[model samples]
Target: MHVLWRGDTLQRLRLVSGLILFTFAATHFINHSLGLISVDWMHEMQKWRWVVTRSWPGTIVLLAALLTHASLGLYKLAGRATLRLPRWELVQILLGISIPFLLLPHIINTRIAHVFFNVNDIYVYELAKLWPASAIIQSLLLVIVWVHGCMGIHFWMRLYPAYRRIFPLLLTLAVIIPLSALGGFAVAGSNVAAAIEIPSVFANLKVLTRWPDAAASESLAWLRNLARIEFGAVLAVIFGCIAWTYFARVAGPKVTVAYTSGPTVRVPQGPTLLEISRMSRVPHASVCGGRARCSTCRVRIERGSYGLPPPVFPEVVTLGSIGAPPNVRLACQIRPEHYLIVTRLLKSETAGPEDIAIEEADSAGVEKTLAVMFVDLRDFTRLSEKRLPFDVVYVLNEFFGVVGAAITEHGGWIDKFLGDGLLAVFGQRDGVEAGCRQALRTARDVDLALDHINAKLEAELGRPLAVGIGIDAGPLLVGRIGYGESVDFTVIGNPVNVASRLESLTKERDVQLIMSRGVVRMTGWIPPAALTDQVSVRGVAEPVGIIMVKRGRELPADVLALRAEEKEKEKPAAWTAGFWGRR
Candidate 1:
């Protein structure tokens, strides 16, 4: 009971064991690929590999990992309150369970025969036996094992910040290794078949003496049959445990789960809210497939919240990172032991792979000094009042296109579009200093882009387009917020609100851009004393320090020139701080 309940430790052990087994499988496939050159090459590589893997210590470690991983996997599955899972998770599980059945027979014939019956079990001998008869099964074993290992690796690796950058290379190797191994096996098998046709080669091969005697061959057969029976018994016991757990949960007690969305379901006790939602066919978001890495599956307990167990470590980390309130809990982590009314925080239909693909800086969430920018086109509404609806929409899309491009180009993401305005946040992945510098440059680019747009629309429009830009930099609580389809990954704090106020102030102040003093300072630039002012901002108790620019294009020439010189001085230190140093 103690061992089973320590889920975090068991999960870590399972990951370690899985990685060890994956390494072995990868190396074995690489050895098999050597057969592409010649069967002798395969044997040569195998001999080198055997130095570690075929040794007593290596064998013991390999067997231990195999047992640990298999048992842990079975236990994890049996512990699941519901069999319903994401498509990829279900596929990985099915493939993992299928591996032992296909693999045990092969292991018995080769490793067992080598140790007990003194069979050579060399590539040529085995290939000759396997060529046309056992080829399909061996191929299946190779693919199933590789895919299962790769999926497990994917599930684990995707949680990291660097996984996305290295994924393409990983995917290529995954595909190439298995195909090369299968190709090598086919070529080697053909060579063996050809050699066997020659009387001299066949005699030298000693195909009949591969097994010591008829008795040894009969004994190998009996061992394989017994191994199959033993494996079957183990599987049967695992399934029996799962079935007993399910039936016991059903018969022992029942609870009513009332969803705020108006569905009240009577589900058996034991399943988590997520499992219950799936069982009841309710729409609930789970971007990390119930792993608790993403808090998209969070639900607010509307009623019956008392007596609930505390969140586990993973859930605590995720919820704390996102700054979730006290009443909210991860649906995937908590089992409703009693009747409870809950509301899903995110819409399942709107959640996608991208929802879990958080950036390096925004893994869950935390406080970071970031540059927040707000851009709004001035008087586009009045311009649209006289123009055709089609023309208005067309020009608006074009306006947004340039704005979006400039935002992304300057290392920020457009958090959301506000009809004629948009919010962009920087330093989410890059640092605050870079974000401030980039925001200044983005303002300049937007001003330039508008000029080009105005030139193109000169005949259609009586006047040129105009825009206001605002930038602020400070510590902000950055994370995903909102419910259902309206969920947004955004920053919230004084800085964000200040930026919005500054953008609106641009119209009254008659300027193209307005930036907080902190933003200018973060960029390593001192604003001109004459251009700076202390002004009262709506909703803010104190006056805010700001630097205004009448025209963005003129401002960057002075600001970026000073920055360029500073960056030149930094080149030496920057070179020392390469990819890893950036972190």
Candidate 2:
């Protein structure tokens, strides 16, 4: 069989059809609102509405739009791999698909009654035939159609920059429009009820009903029966589609999609990555709910790209408009055929207790330019031997907090907690220059925090403690290394190893902080006073030049000073005679 429409064409057609339907509903509501003035005025306004919507051309548009919209909606619903969606999206779907079934009875009693029973398709005819029940039922149909149309508008306009600003005004209209129609409808029903008690009003209503007494009751019963059958059949088809969706999930081939945060979810091959996230109860952000209308559900593919299909036209247009990276694609559009690994591009969007805990993606072997800082306690081993094990643990915990605050305060993220030391990286969010500067500032502050910790301990144990800090900057691999839920996000490279050696050198050199010339150069800052020397680092034969920064010197660099309170902190001056003599 030949397909008549492409997905893109169908999408546009759905929009056109929905707009057509909304227009009809709006006019019908306006006619109902006229009942607030008088029932006769309501009928008069409806005559104009009938010309606009119930005439030959209008009827064609209305019927064609209804069939097209409902069919396309059901087709899309069946094609969706997973039904897990945001509450609003689910509500819109439920209400829209319910339109055919819910309005069947109203459709029969009016249009069918007029055809078979010779009743006028007007207010007085409705009063004579169905009376009170018709008003309430038609109002229910109006609400469902209005809400469904409003939801369509919301999904289309939410990504526009101005939508958020105008949301309140739009929401008020959404509520008031349907409510006014219902209120006016109730008033018209009351008028009809009052007319039943008055002879003149009843005489006027009798002219509208042309139902033949002999056939009227039989025709009305047949109409109600046909409506009930249509309603039941539509429900069965909808429920069957839902059942098929469930069975497809259960019986389809499954593929693994691994997240950088150590979650490996197995999902059926047909669903988009966003659908898999939803099916697995992973909170993925989809502001437009997988229709590719919003790019909130973007992901950066880390591995297995060869197994995925090329971007379709819709995905291409959306990604191009946003200027997304080549590796990044909307999760809602990507349907993977094989194993894959990915990281969420926008972690903040899925930030809630129910959402999957998203942290920094581990860059296994990917190289990055970063500044590494290593801080180690000089006398921790001897102190741990002297103190009780419980006390040692307590003291180490306290020390971790102090050093952690200092590193974090200077914009460095802790990479790992060593036995008596910690390794940190800077410039992950910024660049190498800023990272190097943050490492320098952190080294100084950690020295100060160490001093404070030592002062408190000195009063308790009559001995002060000391710490050594080393800073180095270079390209290194930064990512998760462990497996089976024991993953660790860390950095490893010559620079990291060199920094550790320098930290060890502080104990021998008896200085508070040691840094390589590489760190200083990376920071792009000229220092006032600093001790300089060549020290052999492990795994390297040639000695690397190092700079030992002293206390009370200013760091006069733009990269370091930007949004940081570390300008007055360090001054690196060349090591004069006997720089290590005091220690």
- Specify the highest-TM-score model's number: 1
Which lDDT tens digits does candidate 1 get at residues 429-544? 55788788878888988999998899988678788999998899889876556553344456778988899999999998999999998898887777678889988887789899
Best by lDDT: 1
> Clash number for every model?
0, 10
Error of 2 at 429 (Å): 24
Q: What is the Cα-based lDDT of residue 240 in candidate 1?
A: 88
Query: Which lDDT value does model 2 have at 211?
Result: 42
RMSD of each: 7.6, 12.6
| Residue 119, candidate 1: alpha-carbon lDDT | 77
TM-score of each: 0.73, 0.59
The C-alpha stretches of model 2 lying farther than 4 A from their native spots are 1-7, 115-117, 127-131, 209-217, 348-583
